[model samples]
Target chain A: MKRFTRSLGLTACAFLALCGQTQAADDIPTIRVGWSIPAEEMKYWMMRRPDAFPDLGKQYRIAWTQFQGTAPMVQAMLSDAIDCSSQAPLSLGQGAASGGLQAYVLAQHVGERKGESFSVYWAVAEDSPVRSVADLKGRTVGVNVYGSGVYGQMAMILKQNGLDPERDIRLVETGFPGSEAALRAGRVDAAVMNQPFALRAESKGGIRKLFSLTDLMPNTVHIFEVCRKDFTDAHPELVKRYVKDLRTAMALAREDRAETLKVVSEVTRAPVDLLDGYLLTDKDFARSADARPDFEAIQQMLDQYQQLGMLPAKVDVAQFRRDDLIQ
Target chain B: MSAQAILQRLGAPLTVLVLLTLWELAARALALDGFPTATESLAQLPAILFDGQSLQSIGASLARMFAGIGLALLVAVPAGLAMGRNPTLARMLNPLLSAAYPVPKAALMPMVMLWFGVGDLSKILVIFLGVSLPLLYHSYHGAARLDDKLLWSAAAMGMRAPARLLRITLPGALPEVLLGCRVGLAMALIVMISSEMIARQSGAGDLLFNALDMALYPDVYAMIVILAALGFALDWAFEHLRLRLVHWAEPRQDAASGGNS
Candidate 1:
């Protein structure tokens, strides 16, 4: 009887100790970060290269959630499902304004840097008569989404070439995976394609790029990291640690391209052969060394979107911009 | 079992083998960039099933699918029976159901996620929405055709309204309810996969998209095969249960207007 009583007391003590540890750990915030596949989100792969993020487990931990697109990611933020995610400029404007979400930009993920980086392209078959944006007029073009950044870029190029994007081109919504197939099938004259797909098409030797996003919006911040206002309000220090770790990870990813692709391959399950020599190189979208979000470029994109009658109302980027987080 | 029955049992598997063979031929002939041969896709199946993450994802998806169907069964069956019996209730709900019928349930994922968060509840709810309509429609038709004389006889025996509903209407409508369940079962899987694909978080659908996004052609086709196999297995098991439950009901097949009782 005495031995049984002693064992029960020990178990009770152990349970109490565990509860105390949990309580202490709860004080350190774990940020729920959202990301999509094929975009090469560096922070999502940070755990694979733990040495890159010094403050990963010490100051803050990340609970990464994969999403299909930025639209759903924004929905997740609105519902408090995720605290932050890497968002495109168009989505950022729409999500904040429509959802009444106080989403703040923390740091840039990928963008055009001095016109020496990869951007989305509208490519056609090499034998096709279409050689420029104007030539695409009265032709059926393929876009992944109507209002996505890629689509916005395509629309801007079309407008500059004096063609109505809505009237002239019958924009078929071909998903990124099916873009090459759709183009090769003669279903589309040109398809707006992003990294890896663009690289794959290039390597295959039939597609000819007419114009890229850079041709229209030079030095554009295509994607940037964003956090919910509530998360930042409650856990400012955690957000700061996250930014610091993100910057460190970005710098390391830039330095060791081979190692970075290995981690990306592990996370995405894309064969390293497909990613190597292209991803994180000059062929990929440029990542800011210090992880800075360009407020001016973001505003310019929003203004252009508003002017093009895409956005319902004008969104001043300053309302959602947070310059304090990007150190 | 007799020889005829044995051959009948073997028919589906034989068809599957033939289809796979044809796929192999077509893929090899085309030799498209991202399309993989049938053998290559089948070779990837073992790896996918054995992987811990993949199994967990699929398991989570199945859990949600079942939960949604179970919830629909609980709510839709009784409501459909009541609607079937009462013309007023049927009149009220018919238009609403008709309106919602054409709206793809998967398209509601974003709004559902916004309301319920990107958790199991939201996914289950969308699957429930997808499944409920078919179950309700079939169950209502089943109950509507329940011989009024049989119900009247039960009433003459001093059976209360609720008791008659439980005892007579439920069993009478069950075959149709089960048929609805069969359709709902398929709808459940469709909604589950599509919602997961749209949400792109975790599940069989997410796994499929992940493979697609990564351009892992073999893995993509392998995931499709797994989903197809899962749908087939579930349908076969449910069909067996359905047959056993409605053994006395005269064999009836679906038609353009309605099936003969």
Candidate 2:
């Protein structure tokens, strides 16, 4: 009887020790970050490097998560499953305004540049007679998602060409990689594509560029990094460290083409040649690593979305910016 | 076979052909770019079926569907049997089952992904959830509604409990179980396709979705055709299997409709 009692006591003590250990582990400052696939999110690639962001890792354990698109990523943020994520500006704004998610834009991940650099392109089959946006009347076009940045750009472009996006033509939602095949097969008159898919499709040589994001709205922000407002308020230091780590990684990626290509190739599983064609140039990096959100550009997107009835009302772009965290 | 009987058998095929003709005419008349005529979609089917990528996608989707339905059967059948036999177990599970039955399985997808990751396991779980409820309900009803005369006869014959359950109760329940399996199988395919479209790296759903993204309208139609053929073939196979296993049971009128009794 005494032996059984002693064993039970010992088991109880051991269970308590385990509980305490778990509590300590839980207290170790962890942040879950979400990213979309195919776009080659820089922080995820940088995290692969053993020597990169040493201090950040030491300060906090980074839990990285992958998502298929901005909508899912935004869903994760709303559910408190992820503290931060990268999303298209239109997605972030629409999600914030509609879902009532307290999210702040931290930095621009991809944006439009004048004639030198741009991320999104509208492309059609080379054999097709459709020369311009005017030719797209009563035809089908493709976007990655209905409420995504690509869709916004397509809508804006259609409007610019005196076409109503709703009644003028049909817009189908297609993934970036799939858009290339659809364009080739004549499934759509044009597909709204983003880098490195646009670059890859161009290299294949049967698709013609119908228009670019810059063609419609020059020097605009397309995609940006965002974090939940409550998370930033509660863990300001961790958020700052994350931003610092990201900036350092972006700078490193910009300076070392070979290293960046190696990491991107590893993450995306694309060939080095494709990565070289897409990433190894000043013009490419210019659009990719802009560390600050252009408020004017963001406002332009907001106004455009509102005008198109995509957003319920105009949201103040400045209110969503977290320049302090980025700095 | 009599001439009238043969003509009656051709009704389904004739209706299908008529629908296809209408569809082809409508597509041509509308002249909608990217909307393929039935002929265009059918012509592309051979190439799509032969493509390595498409074949792999079909295989992956089928594998997930079978695995999910198999898993659902493994758990649901036994649990359902136990619940139907014991009033206490039925009371415990019926409320919970009914509560969950009406909830959209897709809504649970995000939570499932959080738990299982965006992999085959998550998609399988979604399909499993979708299939298991109808299976459980059918199984419970099958066991619970067993003829009292048969049970009384088995008891009077001095047959043991296990033997009676195996020989009489289970065989009697086979028709309902098979009916549940058929419904579950169809649900499994639908849930699998939706989950794949949302969370997949590859599958028939991904193939269809990607094809649409690239604006490959004929490929999209071809995928739809393949999915329809797959569902029809599987349903036919299940019906044959059911007729074989439950040969003693009265032929159900609703069997042709594939509808629940």
True contacts kept of each: 0.65, 0.06
lDDT of 1 by residue, A286-316 (tens): 8877878888999989988887777779899
| Colliding pairs, model 1 | none
CA lDDT of each candidate? 0.85, 0.77
Q: What TM-score, over all chains together, does every model reach?
A: 0.88, 0.66
Instruction: Give the alpha carbon lDDT tens digit for every residue of B1-261 in model 2.
Output: 998898799988988899899989999986554678999888879876887867887898889888889999998977777677778999999999999999878678888876776667888889889999999999899989988788889899899887877788778888998999999988887887887655564578756765554345777888888888889999999999998888878656788568776
User: What local lDDT does model 2 show for residue B17?
Assistant: 96
Candidate 1 wrongly placed segments (more than 4 Å): A1-28, A47-61, A97-99, A162-170, A312-314, B1-9, B85-88, B147-168, B250-261
Prediction 2 global C-alpha lDDT: 0.77
Best prediction by lDDT: 1
Model 2, position B85: C-alpha lDDT score: 76
In candidate 1 the C-alpha lDDT for residue B252 amounts to: 46
- Model 1: per-residue Cα lDDT at residue A62: 83
How high is the lDDT of residue B50 in model 1? Answer: 90
